[model samples]
Target: MDIHGTIKIDELKKPYFVWFEENWIHDDVLHHHQKGQLVYVESGFQYITIEEKIYLLPQNHAVWIPPNAVHKTNSHSEKIKLMIMFADISTQESFYYEVNVFSVPPVLKEMIKYAEKWSKQMTVNHNENLFLKALFNELPQFVEHSLTLHISLPKDKRLAKVIQHLHNHYRNEIKMEDLSDTAHLSFRTLERIFKKETGLTLSKYQQMLRIIKSLEYLSSGNLTISETAYEVGYKSVQAYTRSFQSVMQFRPTDFIKTIQ
Candidate 1:
């Protein structure tokens, strides 16, 4: 959804704007706006590129885009549902300065969905405006308490191939030798370069990718915990729970409850 068309969001007189889009498809063109933006995913995942870095936005999560930050979002799936907000209020807090992707608590998610009634603008000093302000005020606390499930992509061609291999084979057992061969580098060289490019160890990055994939499985509502764990390459539910908690700060069962 590009706000750069004839209807510029910054020109609106309201202090806040909210839009809930269903089965949405984005233009994927790089664009930015004057007001800070918050995008929450109700279903399906979105890939958001900010400043040349791509972040994964899974279901039941939200991403914050700072004011005037060049960003673009894309989703190949046609079932994506998004709750978007444009806020004109001043936010000098550190978290508001850069893009962040964090899990949305059930309460905050409900509050945001409740705002679907008012789309573009809400009258000032009215109940709708007050409700939206309360919802926005509650976001920072949730962000502080929740872990940001950071999933980023590499730009280097060799590393990009390695990343693709990992993405395609995350459900199976992959070894360092295989990854090294995929990258066409020595094991040690691949390790050093992968860490340097992604700021994450290869093992950690792979585990994060697996867990993110597992989120997709669980959100579908057709998989049991054991089924989802097995789909993500976990030999046992215990191991899967540990890895999921390490990345999400919550257990798989807890996340399932959120979706239910």
Candidate 2:
């Protein structure tokens, strides 16, 4: 797929910067990225959906998306933000997805502005890298608003095990018995608890996840419909097509072509 590529401004020796001043959500955006991304709202508000979790970011906060993850963006038409995308993660690898409500410290603020300037100027001096490194070191996360996953997301042991297993293997038929094993409960008990916790049936959640992955693939435009179906673990194209159509109101090929 011809990606309506993010307006990237990366220097070979410096950071990649993006500054969206206004309703970037209305502008064309394709898939997410292959490198870590830091999205900080300098002004106005924006809503982001990542890994089935949602975050509403206002000024003074930022959200991070690890490489290759499925993410969606929502912006108020007046929203203005500057995003810094990089191949490098300044914090520990484990902290990559843990970013939320990061208080933009004085140092981090200017560094971001310098990067934005460079994004427009198309150049950065050697000393810029040192300042950039220092800024990322202590970008404080806001304590007041509670850096939360919007939907009271639980760390249910049952859900955790089921997720890992499906992630490792979503190609097989989604069997209630198998899911029950992951949850260490009888199928009936597991279903009841899963529904209560996530507000979605086990089957529905699994389907949603598959569809999200499928859309990411569709963004590439390179995968044939059959290839994408199997890639996301659908055993057959017809079954995958049905699911995609039911959820997204479009077949894979048609979606790709429409986006292209």
Q: Can you tell me which runs of candidate 1 are displaced by over 4 Å?
A: 1-7, 10-13, 52-54, 76-78, 122-131
Error of 1 at 58 (Å): 3.9
lDDT of 1 by residue, 94-167 (tens): 77777777778878887888888886553554777788788777777878654455566677788988888887
For model 1 the TM-score comes to 0.84
- Extract clashing residue pairs from model 1: none
Per-candidate TM-scores read 0.84, 0.48
At residue 70, candidate 1 shows an lDDT of 87
Point to the candidate with the largest lDDT.
1
**Across residues 16-117, which tens digit of lDDT does each residue of candidate 2 receive?**
434434434433343555556677666555656666665555454566667656666644425455454354554554555554544455556666776664
Worst 10 residues of 1 by lDDT: 1-10
